[model samples]
Structure formats: C-alpha cells, structure tokens
Target chain A: MIRNLQVAPDHYLLELRLPAEFPCPEPGQFMMVRLRGRDEPFLSRPFSVHNFRMHRGSVSLEILYRVVGKGTLLFSRQSKGTILGILGPLGRPFRISSICPTVVLLSGGIGVAPLAYLAHRCRGRNAGGKRTSIIVYAGARNAQSIVGIKHFEAVDLRICTDDGSRGFHGPVTALFERDLCSYDPEKTMIYACGPPAMIGSLARILEATSFSCQVSMEERMACGVGACLGCVTAVKDNGGRIRYERVCREGPVFDIRDLAGLKTDPC
Target chain B: MNASGTFGFGEEFAPFVDLNELGALVVKGLSWEPRQGNPPPRIIETVGGMLNAIGLENPGARAFIEEKLPFLRQYDVAVIANIFGETLDEYPRVAEALSRAGGIKAIEVNISCPNVKKGGIAFGADPDIAAEVTRQVKTATDMPVIVKLTPNVADITDVARSVEAAGADAVSLINTLTGMAIDVESRTPQIQNVTGGLSGPAIRPVALRMVWQTVKRVSIPVIGVGGIMRAEDALEFLIAGAKAVQIGTANFVNPQITLEVIAGIEGYLIRHRMDDIRDLIGSLIEPDSLEHPHEP
Candidate 1:
C-alpha cells in the first residue's frame, strides 16, 4: 500500500503497490480486498479499480471506497503500510466495441470508481486512432459525496447532486435525456454503475431509446469469486426466460437490455 | 469433493479448477420444482465466517438433468446429485428423477438445509424423519446414497445412526450451523432472512467434534465438511475418522483452494513416507486410552 487518503466524506482512495509481475486489470474489473490478519470481517470486500500505473518494477492500483459498513470502516483507518489480502481483476469487465463512435459513462456515488477507469481507457483508445468521443455523467447526494470527478477532466463532464449543490440540479440521467439529440443512438453505447434506483431509472428512461447500454451491478458479495453463488442477479436469457446469474463470475457488468425487469432493491 | 451449493453444479469454476482431480462433485441442492430462494441480502460475512440463506434455489431436477448433467458428464469426477425436498414424498421423487438420469455416481440426500421454511433442516433435526428420508431415497435410487446430516441437531450421532440404519451407503457430517448477525445502526438483521446457516473457519472446531462423534457411533463412512480451507483442516477430519472431506465456504475465497488442498495432503503423505493416503484415516492416538499415560 502506498497512499490511503480521504477523497470525500466517508470515502477514501487507496493506492496499492503490487508486484511488478501482477496481471493488469481491465477497465471495470474489481478486486476483493481484506485487511491482513483480520478475520472479524470474515469475507473480503469488493472494490472496482479506480486507476492504475505499471512502473519499472512495480504495479500500483487505486481503489475508491466508502465506509458503508464494518469491513470498509476498518479500511478507512488503515495506514500506508497495511497489508491487504487481495483477489483480483475478478468479474467480467465493461465491453467497448470499436464500431461505437461515442461512449457515455454514467455513475452514482462510489460507482464512479470503475467508470473513471473506463473513461481513461476510452481516451487511450481514441489516442490510438479510434474515432470515439467520451461523455461522463456523475451524480451524488451532495458535493461531499461526489468522487472521481478529476479523472473525467479530459471528457465532457456533467455533474449532478440531489441537493442542488453541484452542476445539474436534477438526477444525472436528466442530462443524458437533454443531450439525447447530440449523438446517433445507433453509434452510441452507454455504460452505467450505481445504486439500483439510479440504474433502474436509467433503464426505464432507455426503454424506448435504441442506444445499447451496459450496467455494473452491486450486491452484498461474500466471495468475489464464482464459487459462493452468494451474489446473484436475475437476468433474462435469449429465450426471455429469467435465470439467476452470479455477478461475481459471469458479470458485475451486463447489458441493460439483457436484464428484463430487474428488481430495484439490492440483491 | 466440493459441497452442495458451494460449487454450483461444477460449471462456474471449470476454468479455474480441474474437476477430474476431485474425489467427487456434489451439485447444488435440487428440488421438485424451481425455487426462487430467499429474498435479497441472502448472505453476509460474520466473525471468522459467513452466513447464507440461499433457501436451496435450483432449476428443479428435470432442468438439472437437461441443462447441467450433460456438462458434468464430460468430466471424470464422481458427480453426486444433492437432492432435497419440500415434503417427505418429494425426497424419493427427486432421487428417482436422478436415478433415471443415467450419469450420476451417487445421490446425496440433503436433509440439512437451514434456510427453507419446511422439509429441510426440519427433517434432519429428528432421527425418525432423517431415517425415513434416507430410506425413501435409498429405495428410489440404485446409486450410492449419502445422507448429509445437519449440525443444528441436538445429537448428530442420533441422526447419523438413523440414516445408517435406513441403509445409507455413507454419511456426510456437519452441514452449516444456523446463525444470525444484526446491523447495529440499522437495527435489523443483516440477511433478509431472519436467520442463516454459518460456515467457515469459525465452525470448523464444532464440525470436527461432530464428525468425530458420528464416526465413533456409526459404521458408515463419514464425509467431513464445514470450513476445510486448507489441507491441514481436512487432515484433522481424516484423522478424526472421516473417509473424505468436502470443501465449502473456502471455495468462495479461492477457486484453486481444493487443488491446493489435494497437493498439500499429498505432500504431507510423501513427507511421512506413506504409500497410501488411507493409512492416515482414524489414526489419532488417544492419550487417555494408553496404559501408561504421561501426566502433563
């Protein structure tokens, strides 16, 4: 661990320096982290990669987390030298096809962590001659809850706070609704990660739209691996039949359209 | 073997593990009909363990035979179908369904699920019902029958004996113990289900003791389960008289843990100059039984 600092109230950004040979995680892939030598919180907590840098002899990855419960509260007090049992790059990552000319990244609260990495990757792809534009819509309860805004500096940024303390006074999806005319729905792909309510509303708004969208879901996960079957989300198969899919394995990232009538409550 | 419900019919971890290397693979608990399971917040991490209330959610036995069994048939691993029921009659029906499926190596009667409202732990909690379920399953199938006993019972040996008397080929001891966790600030249960089954390192000691007692009391082989995260934990169970062990909660932490455990046990046997791993079974020395015991 190198840096552990508060990026917002109750939220902290942790930078872990892993071995040079550590496999790099793709955008939207998450890591399961637990404090070394602690079993009070028996299972490791999952966190999406916020940023990463592979240097000459080391690889450092950043994780943005909030003190939502016991495991995270312990994470907030850890110092730079604390050892954490890390399991990684788990779950399916966000898929971006080159055919899509525009990518819309939407996030709520700490969900911004993975989208930040996704935005960075989009910028890198664009630099490599792929004609793609990036737009980020970030929403939070208040200014203090806003996170990862700086990572989206190069993209068109739209910020929304529920209390009207930030850029857009309404929900972030409203901005996407207002800007719907700017891009061709056929050429655009929207990726969202956040509270179920926010994602649910976004899904509802996109019902009549033709833009393809993917959502990164959050569930109370015990094992960030596929074995547990603890973190499952209901998804519709090709036959329009519902089946419980493990979020830790098959995906935390899934096509919004594939989720037929997803429940608004956390699973 | 990977315990029921932990390995999800053996398809999810196929990329991470070699199913052929396992002694057996116990698929998730199958029922007469598809079960939606408990509501959200079905699992939560506790001190040195985790609690789950999955309620045995499955695609039903017919769906299992159609969708999952064929995939499992590709592997050399002994596939054990862990069957459960919502009522007494459903047990034989589930077993008979698997019996006609033609590929399963054995049938594990799951009379130990604590998450359901009926016909699960309730059946395992009593000796007569446990025996009846075991007898019905045994009559319904020609495959080897293994009765998985719940640790939630007053005396697991009683349940073990009943299953043994009912002609069960073997028994799997120590299913998850019923437990609960509360969120202080929210002033509510952490899991949506008021109570859940606890399994992990925290429950290992209790499971071992139960396995030991059951081993001493019954004539059948015991498959020890509950928090066998490492090879050493499994060895403890083997020494205490378990014929085999099942890896459960630890599979969540590390998908390769089962293979690691197999390697570790092999290493220990090689270090001890043992040709066969069976030599270590029930090899514990009882200090009290020795004629000239050292007073410490």
Candidate 2:
C-alpha cells in the first residue's frame, strides 16, 4: 500500500508499497499499474516511480492526468483502499555521477517525476557536504499540469507555459537553451523527461554542446515491465546503425547520443 | 520452454496449476551469462495469439543456478533447462552449469534464436554446426540433452539427424517461428524489436508439420512444443509421434494449461483403452501397423 496520496488538484501523488522481493528500483525505473473495473483498455499502463522509500516498503508515483480516458478518469476517482494489479519497478534508471558538483534537470509537466527522484537521490546521499544543486526548467500547457510547483520550493525551479499563461511564454526547451549558454557544460550534466517535442527540441539544443545528457521517455506501454517491449526507442548502436530498445528494460533513461530519433514505441 | 519471453520460470504459473502433473517442466531459455535483452516493445498481442522478441533474457547460468533453482526443487516435474548462447563454447559452459545445479532433470539446447546478429548461424540452420554444438553440450554434462529444433529452417530433418548422431539423448521441436506485427497510423512496427518470434494458435499447423518431419528423421524421443493451447493440441503432438509435449504460449493465456492438458490427455487415453502412454509414442498411423492391427 502506498502511504501517501498527495492530491494536487490535477495530479495524484500515489505511493505504492514495494514488495520486499521486488528488485530495488533505481532513479529512472517505472512501474505498470493495472487499472481495475475498467474494460475498455485491456492492459496495464506504465508509470515511473517518482520517489522511493525502499527501507519503508513504499514508492511514490506522480500521476499527472487530465481525467480524459476511462483509465485515467477511473484511476482518479478510485478510493484509497483500491488494490491494483501492478508490476515493476521496471526498466533501467538514470546514472548520476557522484563527482558532478552541479546538475541540470530538464522536464516539462509530469516528466518531472523521474528527475525529482534523481534530485532526491542526490540529496539522499550522505555526501560530505558536497554542494550539488539541481536546476529545473519545467513547462506545461498551462498551470494545471504543472501543479506540483510547491513540492520543489527548496530546489531551484523555473516554470514555462505555452500560451504565456505562466513563467516563460514558450516550451521548456527554449528557456533551457538560453540558460544553458552560461551554465558550465563541463561540470553540469543534464537529465530530462517529457513529451517527444520537448525531448526532441532539447536534443537539438544540446547536439553540439559538451554536456552529457539522458532523457526519460513515455510511450503507450501495455506491460510496463520489460516482458513487453512495447516502449522501444531507436538507439544508434556502435557502428552508427539503429536498433530497437525497450524503454521498460534498457531504459526510461538513455544517453542523448544513443537516441537516433525522439520517438516512442507505437501504442 | 517459456517461448523466450512469454513466461518466466514456473513460479508465476504455479498458483493456477498443480505443476507436478506436467510431464516435463521446460523453463524459459537461459544464456551462458546474463543478458540485458533487446529494449522494450519486446512483446505484442494478437487475436488468439501473441508474438515476442524477448531476446532470450535470462540471469546467466550462475545466477540461475544460485538464485532461481531453489523454487523448483520440490516439484516432481521433469525440469528441462533450455539453454542458448552466442558461440559454441558457451553452450557447453551453460550445460555444465545447469548440470552442476543438480535439480534440473535435463538440458534442452535451443539452437534457433534469430535475434542475435552474429557468430553461429542459428543452430537448426546448419546441420554441421548443430551437430558440433550438440556434441559439445552432450559431452559436457551427464544429464540427458534435448536439442530443441527450430521451425525457421528449410530442412529440420537434417539438423535433427545430425544432433541425434552427435549424441543428443532426445529432441524437442518447433521453437517459435520468426514473424512481426505493425502499428498502422504512425506506420511503425508495434514491437520495439521490429520483428518478433510468432507463437500461439496461429503457428500450430506449421509447428506440427515441423515436428512430424523431425519425428520421422530421428530415432530419439521428440518433445512437441509451439502454440499448444488445449488438451487436444497436446494430444495432437502425442499422435504426431512426440514422446512428451511442452506448453509454451498457452501458459501466457492460461497458466493452468499444463495440468489441464495432462487431464485431457489422460481422459482421451482412457476412452481409447490406451492404458500405457509409452505405447502411444510414435504410434501415428504406422503404415505397416495398420495392415496387422494388434502388432507392435
């Protein structure tokens, strides 16, 4: 059972009880949730474990939805006692360099989930007072999808909106490009997760730059675990050739250089 | 086996099954070492069947022996460790590791993995390589080695005879046939691994034909596999000259299928007064047996 369901209007903060036998999920790992009482969609949908408290047998998932489909609308209305069929924390996680003193977390809307975990992990580590600062450039269509702003008050946060309804009147990538010019590329590593447009735009922005980058992605996945390679990406292999990789297994997190195109697995 | 990715080990299916009733528990294919496997979209579903390109993911021989073996110990089923590898050397090493584990009753060497791009041509493709690899693994372990032939080959009989000559104790057929599916709107392949191994009801006819071909070519016992969804399907394998039968894609649909199939086979046997199952082995319309009805 997830201990907390921190509702922030548009998004539901779901906490899941991680079974003891479950492999400890890393920073970028995601889980598949089987929505009950819904028959239209036949399979489970994958979600990243936004934050984990493995010692306490719980994982916090940030679900940012607009209550559209039966799956989402049904999930949003469910009571706390709901017992869902779920399997995870599937897929590979992001790798944070212990030596990096500064890092940039790029996200748009709910893409913040996995990055939030990365930031928390950096903060979780009992480093000898190592100064690690995470700068987030998060965006959404408007304020609703970006509702979890209050949670990161202590961390540096920058918000963006598409229609000038919020912080910057553009996608998160635009602001990221402007700020990244001054940020030390040698010392700062970028971690991003968001829609394909944002991720693709950021990839274009950072193509010539020296900063190492990884992006957490989303696709219409049935089995959130690697068993179903429904969420695969085209990664450029060693010989400059592209091959499919399951996001649920190889990564929700992957080096930007390895990605051939900013595309998700077909639904 | 678990048809590559459809099933893991026998654990998930146990709740709905009395595993001991299974003639042989063929676990999923394992490699010499651990594999990260191909990236997501490894599996896809179709009407009445499914396809997968799990890339034969397993926890290498070491972890399989160390961590997973314990759960399978109490079961009375014949545990066949299906092994696969990239090269010839890896096959023996995997067989030796599984043999050393002790509980695994036999080793089923899967030679037809098409996902890999290098090294050996799929084991069932070339009779010489198939025979060579079979020789290496059979010599490496004391456990009976069952060479699992693939349907993708043109002449499965050549490889079947080759492996039998190479000292394989028995053989199993038809591993999943290679196939694919696509997503129309975006015009992209549905599986992350663009192509996947096709299994389930769709491949039953193809699988049966290949098993029959191998059955006639080899002297050893044949274990039939592929799209076996019902008791009748298992009966079909027995009637087609298989010594034993394995449930692959059917386990993904109904976990209790192994027991369900056994019950169905026993019920069929009772109706026919076929008291001993061993007598049914290779009893498929024996051309000479029909002329002299009661003669073996």
Candidate 3:
C-alpha cells in the first residue's frame, strides 16, 4: 500500500508499506513496479530503492523516480490506495567494506536514489566504530532538477547544477575533481550512479586517479529476473575481452575499471 | 512445459513456483561456446507485446553441465536442453557434448533465434538446411530431438515437414516473430540491435494459425508455444492439434502461470466429464469432412 507521495520539481517519491515478510533490500538494489489492472504500460518499470524503514510488523520502502515517459507520468498521478505489482529486491548491490574508510557517492539527476540508500547504510556501519566518512556529490540540470536531496542530510553534501543555480556552478565531475585532493586516495572508494554521459566522463577521470570506483547502470528491461536477458551491459573481463553481462542478473553494479571501453561507447 | 530462454534454468523462479509441477523445464539457449549476447537496450514494451534481442547469451555447454544440470536434476520434471550453434558443425558438437554429460532428457534444437547474427534463423529458413541440422543432431544423440521452427519463414510447414522427414521425434512452433519498435522523440530505434523478435499476447493469433497449419503437415507431435498466459490459451492450442504447449513470455509476468495452467486444464477436463486430456487434441469442428486435411 502507498503510504505517502511527495512531488519534487521533475520527479516524485513514492513510499509503500509492505508486509513484514518483505525482504530487506540492500543499497543499489531495485524493484520492478507496475500498476494493477493495466496492460497498456505492459512491462514493469525498474526503480532503485531510495529509502526504507522497518516497523514492528511492517516495512515501508521508498522509490525516487523522474517522469520521463508514459509509465512514470501515470505513476505520478496514482492515489494512496493504488495497488502496485512489484518484483524485486533484484540485481546485485553495492558493497561497503571497512578496507575503504572514506566513502564518496557521486550521482547525476535521479541517480541519487541508490546512493542515498548507500549513505544510510554507511552511517549504520560507522556507528559500530568503523570510523567511516561519507561524502555525497550530487548534480542535476538546474536547482529545480535536483530531487532526493533530503535523503543525504546525514552525510556531507555538495550540489552541482549545469546552469549555476545551485551549490556548485559546474558538472558534478568538476566539483569532484577539485575536492579529490582532500580525501586520502588510498582510503577512498567512490560509488556512482547516473546518466551514461556522466558515467562516461567519470570513468575517464578515474583512470588517472588512484581511488577505486563502482558504478550502477540502467537499461530497458523486460523480466526483472535473468529469463528475458534483455538488460545487458558490455564489460571487459580480466583477460581484457569484452563480454555482455545481464544488468538484471550479473549486475546493475560493476567495478568502473571493468567497464573501461564500453563506458564511452555504451549503447 | 517452459520454453527455452523464457525460464532461466528453473532455479531463478523456484521461490515463486514449484519446479516439479511442470511438464518439463527447457533451459535458456546453450551453445558450443559461451556467447556474450547483444548490447544494452535489448528489450522494449509494445502494445500487448514485448520485443527482445538477447542474442542467446549462455555459459558454454560444458559449464552448463557442471553448474546447471545438477540443480535441475533435483526436480521430478523432465529437463530438455535447448541447444543452438554458430555453424552447422557446431550443432552436432553441442548435442554430442550434452549427450555425454548424461542428465538431459531431450534435445530441443533452437534453429530459430532471430537475435543472433548467424546460423540460427539461417538454418531454419531453408528446408534442406533445417533437415540436415535435424539429421545431424539425431545422429549425435539418442535423446528425442525436437526441432523448434521460426515463424519468419515463407512456409513454416515446409520447414516442419523437412525436420520430420529427417527423423525429428517432435517439433515446436512458432518462435518469436521478427519486429521492431522506435522512440520517435529521440528519433532512434528502441532496441540497439535495430530489430528483435516480438512475443506476448499480440502474437498469439499468428502463433495459433501457424500451429494449426504445421500440425496438419507434420506427422510428429507439435509442441505449441508463443504467448500462452492462461489455461484457456493452452486449451486453444491443444484443440488446434498441438499435443502439448510450452509457456513462454507469460512466465515473466506471473511465475505461477504454468502451474495454474496445468490445474486449469485438469479442471477443464473434470468439468467437461472427460477422462483424458488428449481427447481435446485436434478437436476443432468442421462441416466439410472429418479426415485430416493435409494427408495425401
């Protein structure tokens, strides 16, 4: 059941309260959602987990989405009691380890959804005496395009807008490059999720840096499971040979270095 | 039965549905070597249908036997290995390797995948090439060989008859129809591959017509597959002369659809006071004559 719906400038946040038995999703994991009794928007739409809360006997999950096409436009108008058919906590998730004491999250537009969840997880890990530091760099077209900004309040936040109407007056990558000197390169690990062009630019910049990075990808999907094999991303294996990995199964998250070539020319 | 490439080796959906309840489980398309498949944007949702250009991505036959076969063996349902190839010789080699592994119940030759660049739709489009493929696979393995035919052909019955003449035990029809979708706003094709195979409720009428035509021409059992989402859909195929039907695209929408279809068929038989389900096969009524239409 939908608990709350909040509208941002170009996007919306939907909060759903599910049964307690619903499995807890890790950061970067997603759900395939569809409106019940409708077949026009036939296939389910994939959404990253923006936030989730566990109550005594129930769980509430939040999804942050932009109104890009007909499906999302319809989702924006759904009422409180609207029933949605969902399938997930699907795909591989971001990995947080103590080895990397400084965590940096880079996002573009609605790509902030999964990273917000990761920042929340990093906070829990920090409370256990891990001494982890969380930093988020978020970018959008303009101030109005920025959504899900509140989710990162617990972490140090830096915002960028293309038109210079927000915090930093440039691409997020530019801000990240200027701030790269502050964090210890060896201790920092960057996690990014964003548009293909932004990811492409970041992949190029990371090649000269010592910090390691992981990226979450998006594609048109049919089956959330591996059956359809619809969502695939090209990646170079250890031998430097390119192979197609199903974004729905093998990953939505992969090491940035593994996707070296395809990041620039990804379809 | 679950069609190839629709059910991902039966393990992914085990949590939602019982595997043992299926008539058979046909895993994804396996090949002589591990295929990387096509690039991203491989799927798009159309009106009452969906398109895909997955390109038959799978671990090679050897890796499949080592990793997947063991998990499938635990279930009581028969396991059919759907094998594909890049060349004519690769077909027999893949069949021979699967035969040596010793767990597969049958070999369903996937000669109809349109997503690949070569040897899939190529062999199925020609009657002689389809016959040679069936004959080679039959010689390489003692397991029952079922040749899957594509609907893109000029005459699907000619391809079906050729495979049957080459000693195929049964045949499955109609693989996805070739189609494409475009994003007008971006002015680009929806699928990166430019074209893909269309599947879902939109193609059901075409599949039913193809199955009805092919069954009359071939002597072997026809396993109907194409956009079966309900028990009534399966009944339509059975009544049109298909001995059995495989659930494909519907598995993605609802994993339990196959089980529900099975129970629904049973319920149908009980409601009609019929003792056997086979009584529904080829039950289409005609006023002209009761004789099989395609017989010489």
Judging by TM-score against the true structure, name the best candidate: 3
State the lDDT of candidate 2 residue by residue for B158-253, as single tens digits: 888999999999987887778888887779997777887777777888878788878887889888888787888888888888888877765543
Q: For candidate 2, write residues A1-267 as lDDT tens digits.
A: 343343455577766554566666677887767654333343566677676655555444444444434456556766666777666666778887766667788887778777777777775443324677778888877765575454454568888988878788888888888887778776677898887777777777888988899888766554454434446677898799777676766777889888876643310
> What is the clash count of model 1?
0
lDDT of each: 0.87, 0.72, 0.88
Cα lDDT tens digits, model 3, A1-267, are: 575455567588898878788899999899988876566676688899999899888789999998888788888888788888888899999988677778999999989999998988887465334677788999998888888878776688999998999899888888998888897777888999998878888888787887889899988777788778888788888898888877888788988888844446431
Lowest lDDT 10-mer window, candidate 3 chain A?
A258-267
Q: Cα lDDT for residue A167, model 2? A: 89
Better of 1 and 2 by DockQ: 1
Over 4 Å off, model 1 = A19-22, A55-58, A81-83, A124-130, A181-183, A236-243, A257-267, B100-102, B270-279, B287-296
Residue B286 displacement in candidate 1 (angstroms): 3.5
What fraction of the true Cα-Cα contacts (under 8 Å, chains A to B) does candidate 2 also have?
0.21
Question: Per-residue alpha-carbon lDDT of model 3 for B166-202, expressed as tens digits?
Answer: 9999999989999998999899999989999999888
TM-score: model 2, chain A: 0.84
Error (Å) of candidate 1 at residue A20 is 4.7
Q: Candidate 3 chain B, which ten residues in sequence have the lowest lDDT sum?
A: B286-295
Best by DockQ: 3
Query: Please, what are the lDDT tens digits per residue for candidate 1 over residues A20-133?
Result: 887899987899887755557757889998998887887999999989888999889989888888888889999987778788989988889999989888885642245688
Q: What order do you get sorting by DockQ, best first?
A: 3, 1, 2
